[model samples]
Target: MNEPTLPTLHWTRRALLATGTAGALSLLLPPVAAAAPEEMDAAIREMFGNGTIREGRVSVKLPPIAENGNSVAIDISVESPMTEDNHVRRIGIFSPRNPIATIAEFHLGPAAGLAQVSTRVRLAGTQSLRVIAEMNDGSLWSGKASTYVTLAACVIG
Candidate 1:
């Protein structure tokens, strides 16, 4: 009696070569670095689109020294009348050294009554934080503050 034939497995030469090449390339390439100032600038430009970012009518509040970067409290306020004719349209929080430069963005209208936002954000390390307020009139106002973090957050493998 003839024994049952076992199923055969085949690997194409091209497939084997391609797999080897990919593995070699992965070992040779360096890991991606974290975000930088240029990334932050790109993010800002994407948001405001070359509009002059004037420094005023905005304020950012944060602890000068944060015990941990995982959950840092931040407050952003923009001076605006909060009316239909004149109001803060949006607020963007930025961290240059964070893995993601743009931390948070808030949208508001005349009905909101106040142009302020409070929240917790994760910082990769000690970095300069910037807050940009976009007005309905197509103008930009900014505020900047620095913080020292004992422990960093957003660590990447």
Candidate 2:
């Protein structure tokens, strides 16, 4: 009777050791740090140019303590008269601690009749969020809110 032949294994001792060492080292290393405030500013500048970001005419509402960072609810509103001459052109939400500084953005026109937005965002950790509203008059307004997260999302290593 003939017996079936088995395929030969090709992993060498050196290759196995190298792979194991690399995985071990990777597990021991810490996750990369979150984006800094300077980085956030740079991102804002890159998106909106060197325009001054004035803090007012906008409101950021969120829970002071977020139990889960996965789906934290946020409310952003800009005090503006939704007229063709004066309205919110765009709204940008930014996070300094997230893997990416820019979280979300919304665009609106005078037809919308309101400069309010409500949505959910995933946070990497406890950090402050900045909401910037761009007006039709080429002005930028900002609002800030801070929250503590018990569980973090968007973790990177």
Candidate 3:
């Protein structure tokens, strides 16, 4: 007796079209919507416990226009001696238009030398990004920059 052959799956024009449509629809619906300005402010306030955020002291560097939104380079440098008496405690990066407003938080100590950090982040769209640095003396310093994304990575409503 001859053995039975297994059935083969084939892709038809109609099936391919349906699959493409479904994929496109999924892109339209993101996992989380972009956070509003007030939401971002509340997040920062909650983290720092309603402290005053002052400008200067902390330097934030980012290109005015990002060709790719998936990986935007960011550099943060705070004016600190990085000693027991005067050092940077932590640094928080926030993006207002991202699905999650809080991007990253870096903890520093005297061993970290100068108060500086470099990292890359994903931006959903063109928005204001904030960098907050807390010194050992319970003082908060922050910097803000407006970035434009030529190509958006995340879908924003």
Candidate 4:
């Protein structure tokens, strides 16, 4: 005797659309072929596209030499008018040496008063800390500083 046939499910428009969107996003992600040192050119392009980026009005403060890479203090402040027309929108921190290039992102608005943020980050070793700020005027500014670390962190399989 033959077994009864199972029912087949058809793909719906919504399901196909969702799947296609997810597939498109997955294509933009870096491959899983082992993490390598991040290149500034690539990271910047991924973050801001081909927009013009300047190097002023932003400051990234880090210890010239960090005794421990596990917890390095980071301070970023942007000089913006902080008005309805001109304000610092957000800030992003990156470390090229880290396994994960993108470190952190902070959002701000005109109500923030001052475009300043302080946080801690992990570093792999001596590397440059890159900070990029987006303004309400659709402009981007960046700043970078080097920090030397003695003991490294985030080295896991």
| Ranking according to lDDT, highest score first | 2, 1, 3, 4
- Give RMSD to native, each candidate: 9.8, 10.1, 11.3, 10.7
Query: Which ten-residue region of model 1 has the weakest summed lDDT?
Result: 3-12
Q: Which has the higher lDDT value, candidate number 3 or candidate number 4?
A: 3
Can you write out model 2's per-residue Cα lDDT over 32-114, one digit (the tens) per residue? 45888887888788777789889899999989999888999999999999999999999989989886789887999999998
Between candidates 2 and 4, the TM-score winner = 2
Q: Is candidate 1 or candidate 2 better by lDDT?
A: 2
Model 2: lDDT to the true structure? 0.86
lDDT on C-alpha atoms for all candidate structures: 0.85, 0.86, 0.84, 0.81
Q: Which runs of model 4 end up more than 4 angstroms from their true locations?
A: 1-40, 155-157
> How many clashes would you count in candidate 3?
0
Cα lDDT for residue 150, candidate 1: 87
Q: Which stretches of candidate 1 lie over 4 Å from their true place?
A: 1-33
- Ranked candidates (TM-score, high to low): 2, 1, 3, 4
Each candidate structure's TM-score, on Cα atoms with residue i matched to residue i, is 0.77, 0.78, 0.77, 0.73
Mind giving the per-residue lDDT tens digits that candidate 1 earns over 1-157?
A: 4653532323465677889999889768652335788989889888878999999999999899988889999988899989999999989988788867788888899999998889998887888899999999999999988899888875421
Error of 3 at 1 (Å): 79
Q: TM-score for model 1? A: 0.77
**Which regions of candidate 2 fall more than 4 Å away from where they truly are?**
1-32
For every model in order, what is the number of clashing pairs?
Answer: 0, 0, 0, 0
Residue 23 in candidate 1, Cα distance off native in Å: 15
